[model samples]
Target: MAQPTTSILCTDLGFDWPDGTTVLDGFHLAVGPGRTGLIGLNGAGKSTLLRLLAGELTPASGTVRVGGELGYLPQDLTLDTTQRVDEALGIRAAREALHAIESGDTDERHYAAVGDDWDVEERARATLDRLGLARLDLDRTTGELSGGEAVLLHLAALLLRRPDVLLLDEPTNNLDRHARSLLYEAVASWHGVMVIVSHDRELLQHVDQIADLRAGSVTWYGGNFADYERTVAAQQETAERLVRVAEADVQRQKRDLIEARTKLERSASYGKKRSESRNDPKIISGKLKRQAQETAGRVRGMHTERLTEAKERLTAAEEAVRDDAEIRIDLPRTAVPAGRTVLNLDHVRLPYGTRAHLELRGPERVALVGRNGSGKSTLLRAVAGEIGPLEGEISTPVPLRHLPQRLDLLDDGLTVVGNVKSYAPAADDNAIRARLARFQFRGGRADQLAGTLSGGERFRATLAALLLADPPPQLLMLDEPTNNLDLASVRQLTQALAAYRGALIVASHDLPFLRGLGITRWLELDGELRTIDPM
Candidate 1:
């Protein structure tokens, strides 16, 4: 394929805050055809630069240029709750198209400005049918559609806009494996310049290029995330070398300055004695003063130069590992087993106003997998003792840790630190901070409101609180622990669980995660829990 012209180009872009803090200076970037993954840590200005490209944010100075029409999908979309799935895209349009098709009217001259297509309704239905929106009821509420389905509808709407440039932020965030695959298929097949800014490594690998944002600059690494990793590794080594050399130079300068200052002090004392002596020479004292002043000036200049160099080196260090990729966080899993029979329900039904009964027991890595609305979550609540069984004796351990799927247990009003402290008030503040640090929550992030934390951070905080309890619980009940975690966190958590000795009864649809964690037993909702082969 021919290399299309640059979709967006930024030259010598400079932006600063009202408080005079510089966010970017001398930043330059160019985006082109192919899948380009834009990566950075939480606050490394990735989103800001993307906004600059999308014309949402104006540069404080310099120029941002776009070459083509753009269609952008934000990281988080607040979709229409009242409109139907089909209607969300275009209600009256689809309805009229359906009516026209039924009446066999194939005239396009009536609306010649939109398109020159011969049969307008035929074209509309064909597009909807291709996108799988043809069967959906025109009045089915958008809010009722699954997240993946809703996203597809948005894509169909964008198709109607006929954009030549597409930008996506964190696409595949809430999508399942199949849905994520479908999204990738759509992106790969698009005849446009696609630029996706996502942390999903799997998705990144599918892309043709990557633009890694660091230290107010964007560096392009061709051919996906793996290639980007190799490039970053080399760059980090070079940056570290420069930092060490600068540090050594700064230390040497400081020492020389200190020695020179000491000599000046001794010389001044000698000059004072000479003046007091009978044979004292006033000229000698004056010469001594000049010599000291010259040495001091030399030392001061060296110090100033070294300070500037040192500050630059520090910035390099900060930029080198902004997104270190080594996600630091461990979910604690104990080896101490819960006494046999962690959860048991004898002839009991679930969903007091609904249907189904459940029976369970103490088993490690029990999966409560089923279709949506299959009461898998309900069963977890019963096991957790959050809800009483309708007509059976339900038993469970008192010190069990539950990671709810919906995050309903988390109170969004509190800070991450505050939320953990709510359950472990007696725990030392220092200890709490240490726990947060283990989960990659550092700096002033502990001060950030829980209501504002990303989905992954909130879940980590909750998991840390539960796992850090003294006399660690024997039973671990996790409801979709992998829900919002990035790839790095998921891998780390998987390794952590492998080393954990405690019993795990998890509810998740991530089959690979379930299998990799060495699940020793399987629990199907409709049948008895049975032992499975452990890998």
Candidate 2:
């Protein structure tokens, strides 16, 4: 098939980590104009590929070509906390020059700086408003902005540049529902070439196409994420059917081989008897015996070859099927009684003027959601006893564990097994290893240092440590647990939560994840907790 026109292209791209671990070898991609969602497992080199395209990382071999000016938003966008918002937006110089020109200074340098972009401030404000950041003050420092707001500000800066190609890595990682909607709108209206590496389903739904990266290769699927899923499902079905057919073919071949051997044996036995009874010459008898043996050998060889080919076909067919592993564990000890009062908060006042009066009982799953800076994290910390409520009485009748968004609970210097061991010090090494294995940390992986683990691995490690603590938690609180997790990791988390028979409270803006948790109550934290319908 003829290749489509491309604004970004990577030809035979090869890259390796400092430790010589190969990431992408001979990888090739051609992304045309329009938005493309690049998705894969956590460590499938999606981010690495973006860095290569953005010139942040050099390939070990091969070349990357981009059509025009490019703008990139990394997953970990770091802005100097002391820097002013206008400076971070890359409009401070222009704004200053315009002010000077208006103040009666006709300096050539001022005019040169404000060249053609005389309306930079107005455009900047409009862009910020479009991204749901109109409340952000340009004169204020970025340190005052929330994580989601910082991301939006960076995106706004990129928008101002109006590059021919744009790359976003997990752009909605910390965004709330409203902010994500704004981002989706921006993506929908983008006319230039764009590639976004993200696990956000809603963001993926806005893409023009889906580029699935697996095993260092890219497979193009037309339409959005839903369409890609449907196509993949159909392909898997066909692959499974082929595998069954190949398996049957192998079985038939084996049966034919057995029958051929049996028939040859019978013919040889009959011939031997006939030769003996006819009193044929010894030489003639020997020749006939040899011929019979040769015939049997050829038949056996042919049948063996047929069976081997069938098995090979089966292997190929099976290879086409995906086997994404899911986490499965039973935590019976975490179960809460039907009438048990897990937590109670009476006129609780949280940070930022948020208040709540709520009672959580039994194994109720609650989803706490709201806009950016709405204090969902503050509420979770209060429940977990990590932070005290400003003015309220909080009670927890049962033990609880909290998984914060940063996942900073684990010691980077310690191994995954060591971190778990620290949490469950009373448990023996064998017991700890056994539990960690269930979290998909088997053998050497369990010994891997927490600092070196990938985003998905880190999340799993943190979860295992929390769940396997000395006292099994009856109430589990998670704050934006899916922030940096890939889709597979999110599914794995859902599976793990499914096995936990405990009261759960998750603070997140991910409506799909919250819905999948079977939330019994939906509470929005907009200065006060109020019951809301399921999202």
Worst 10 residues of 2 by lDDT: 2-11
Tens-digit lDDT string for candidate 1 (5-111) = 85787899988768777778998887777777887655567666777778887889999887778887766667888886545655345455555655776666324
lDDT of 2 by residue, 1-535 (tens): 9754549989999999999999999989988899999999989999999999999999999999998889999999888999998999999999999999999999999999999999999999999999988988888888888888899999999999999999999999989899999999999999989999988888899998999899999999999999998999899999999999999999999999999999999999999999999999999999999999999999999999999999999999989988666787889999999899999999999878999999988999999999888888888888888899889899999989989888899999999999998988899988888888889999999999999998889999999998988799999999998887888899999999998899999998888888899999999989889999988
Cα-based lDDT for every prediction: 0.67, 0.92
Deviating ranges (above 4 Å) for candidate 2: 1-6, 265-282, 411-452, 468-471
Please tell me which predicted candidate would have the highest TM-score against the true structure: 2
TM-scores of the models, in the given order?
Answer: 0.70, 0.92
Clash number by candidate, in order: 3, 0
lDDT of 2 at 82: 98
Candidate 2 lDDT score at position 467: 90
